[model samples]
Target chain A: DAGITQSPRHKVTETGTPVTLRCHQTENHRYMYWYRQDPGHGLRLIHYSYGVKDTDKGEVSDGYSVSRSKTEDFLLTLESATSSQTSVYFCAISEAGENQPQHFGDGTRLSIL
Target chain B: AQSVAQPEDQVNVAEGNPLTVKCTYSVSGNPYLFWYVQYPNRGLQFLLKYITGDNLVKGSYGFEAEFNKSQTSFHLKKPSALVSDSALYFCAVRRPRGNQFYFGTGTSLTVIP
Candidate 1:
């Protein structure tokens, strides 16, 4: 909960629908990340941004995309929600993109049926 | 690429007993390792990290991690366990030049009363 806030703490959506999760931070950190948490997978990185408009794919970024229009906001979008996409999404921020410790938000739980 | 491994899928310990969650990592250069914990309905929280310097690094919640270079291991340990300490734990690693952290699958810890 380190100065990070994720919107839509819980959401139930249908398959094939589009979903967007928002992460806002007061810390103005240089790096932001989006991750999904599942039972067996633990947490997998979906996307990350080093700065505004700079984004990169992660290990599990196949169906998800992210955007950072401003330093304080990082958005994760699921182009077409799938049952497999039902998981808790977490956002984290760090002062630098290197080996620094990242602080996380509460997370947004999404359920797709 | 850096990687982390958490061998145990689940661990159960009685309250007030000593607890340990195993973690190991692989990286080319000097490795930067970390441990994070997640409670039910909560996001991941930073526990401890191993940079250079000391082999043992102390962190929040009275948790500590020992970095064993020979074994390439950074294990989380607590002298006394509490019921509140029962949660999901994740191990992460980052290379010296890497921009993102690589996380392990995670281990679920159950501290029994």
Candidate 2:
């Protein structure tokens, strides 16, 4: 919970279409992250933002892009959806303090047809 | 690169009995470890973490984890198991100054009544 919300809890898109998932937060946490969860894969980070307009790629950043122009909003986009890109996506926010645990949103389920 | 291992894929326990979900991690130098839980159709929620200080770390829902440097393990334990404890558990590890966490495949725990 933790004041985090993921828009379009479920979504379906064509393989060649572009899809974007939005994450909103009420808390003004300095760090936000995008992660995808799949069976046998656990959670893999796609991208993360340390501050407004600052972003970095994670281990699974391929085929995904993210942007955060504001502190409370983070967006993840799949430029061209693929069957392999279908997964449950989660957004998390973390405090600026060191070693603090991250809070997560419910998640968005994406399906590519 | 950081990695975490959840040795068991599933663990079953009767209600009121003690429960444990094992986790082990690998990282260079000292590391930061974390635990998260996910219910069906939901994202992960923070349980607890091993940052520094004592090896035994207490978390939410009457859960706790022990950080063993020599063993490279952080196992989650609960004195009593509840039916509601049936869910997926994840263990994660990160470097001291790292921004992203590496997660394990996950373990499914079922608490029977």
Best lDDT among the predictions, by candidate number? 2
Question: Per-residue alpha-carbon lDDT of model 1 for A1-113, expressed as tens digits?
Answer: 57999999999999999999999999989999999988778788999999999999999999998999999999999999999999999999998846699899999989999
Tens digit per residue, CA lDDT, model 2, B1-113: 57889999999999999999999888897888899999998878999999999999999999999989999999999999999999999998878787877889999999999
Candidate 1 C-alpha lDDT tens digits along B3-79 = 78899999999999999999988888987898999888888899888889999999999999999999999999999
Q: Candidate 1 lDDT (Cα, whole model)? A: 0.91
Off by over 4 Å in 2: none
- lDDT of candidate 1 at residue A54, scale 0 to 100: 96
Candidate 1 residue A38 C-alpha distance from true site, Å? 0.9
The positional error of residue A35 in candidate 2, measured at the CA in angstroms, is: 0.6
Candidate 1: residue B45 Cα off by (Å): 0.6
Question: Global lDDT for candidate 2?
Answer: 0.92
